[model samples]
Target: MPIEVKNELGKIQVMNEVIATLAGSAALECYGLVGMASRNQFKDGIAELLGRENLRRGVEVRHEKDRTEIDLYIIVSYGTKISVVAQNVQAKVKYVMNEVIGLQVNTVNIFVQGVRVA
Candidate 1:
């Protein structure tokens, strides 16, 4: 007997995972970024199982018909200047997302979550 599989066509919403991964990778590229963690980490065991997801919380993407909005939360090294670090992060992330993902980003919001002593 042959089994038939049903294919469901699903509307793909802008993947939060992809956004997070991009943001995390961009932030890490900066010299001052020490680490990042998502607010979701406190909720479940998600951080332990899916470490990448935890990093993705640093980025929030709101998709619209014409554009996408991105919000980033990050941690910087204690000695780094917050303003400069934030600017670097914004620039890098925007460039990467625009060039690599080819998404029209409407805005990039940067939030400094913490400063890592080390």
Candidate 2:
């Protein structure tokens, strides 16, 4: 479902992909984050890393009446504090969605797919 907003001019619809992109971008900017991870899980239990163009593959957005919830799958650098990285991602995603996209984020959930040495 798209997010609908009405202004003096008319109604605007924000697609899910837009939200996903914003969330993914925000998450990637965090210090410990390596990259976004594709949600598709392999039989060998590995999640593929997604490039910039494929960011939406790592983010899931759900729209409610007044807010949106986001789930982000990411990989972090080895030896970084996982909790701190997750919190940073959550805060950044929430800020971008609210400030840039003008959407209220109800939740930003982070899933750590893997840790890379470099």
Candidate 3:
């Protein structure tokens, strides 16, 4: 589904993939965040880190009513505070989506897929 934004001129529709990529990129910028992780569960129970172009694989975007919801699957650096890092990612994702794309994000949910020493 597309997110619709109405203005005096007309209406703008943002694709769900665009929102997911934006959110994924924003999440990757936060401190202690290693990289975005694919949400697909493997038999080994490990998720591969995703590169920039494939960021959407790790991000899920949905629109409910007038609000946009984002879910991020990420890998964080080992020994970092999970809650603090997650919070920062949430704030940054929300801000970037709102400021850059003119999309107001109602929630940014972070899922810690795994932690790496690096």
Candidate 4:
């Protein structure tokens, strides 16, 4: 189901794919992030890097009860701190979703799929 937003003018519906794309874009802006990874890319302990066009495919958005959650599959640079990168991604995703799209993102779960050399 698409999320509904109400303003003084009218009510608007936003699809989950749109939200996922926005979240994925925000995530890619962070330092040390190589790119997004496919959600189902765990074959033989490897993750496939997704291109810019597959932003929505790399992210999973779940709206349950009164909470909104986003799961980001990512590949980080080999030399960067994994923990720091994940933290930044979480903060950025929430900020962009709330500020740009008017969507309140409650949780951002970052799954480090792989690490690649920059």
**TM-scores of all candidate predictions against the true structure:** 0.72, 0.92, 0.94, 0.96
Among these predictions, the greatest lDDT belongs to 4
Q: After superposition, how far is residue 74 of candidate 1 from its true place, in Å?
A: 0.8
Candidate 4: 10-residue stretch with minimal lDDT: 40-49
Off by over 4 Å in 4: none
User: Which runs of model 1 end up more than 4 angstroms from their true locations?
Assistant: 1-14, 40-53
Each candidate: RMSD to true structure? 8.7, 1.3, 1.1, 0.9
- Candidate 4 residues 20-78, lDDT tens each? 99999999999999999999767788898999999888999999988999999999999
What is the C-alpha local distance difference test score of each model? 0.69, 0.88, 0.89, 0.94
- What ordering of candidates by TM-score runs from best to worst? 4, 3, 2, 1
Clashing pairs in 1: none
Q: What is the lDDT of candidate 1?
A: 0.69
Itemize residue pairs with steric clashes in candidate 2.
none
lDDT of 2 at 55: 99
Tell me the tens digit of each residue's lDDT in model 1 across 1-118.
Answer: 1112223654334456776688778878898887665644433432222245466766777766666677877777889899999899888888987676556577888877666678
Q: lDDT winner between 1 and 4, please give it.
A: 4
Q: Which is the better candidate, 3 or 4, if ranked by TM-score? A: 4
- Pick the TM-score winner: 4
- Candidate 4: which pairs clash? none
Model 2 regions lying over 4 Å from their true place: none
lDDT of 3 by residue, 12-76 (tens): 99899988888888888899999999988644887798888899999999877777789899999
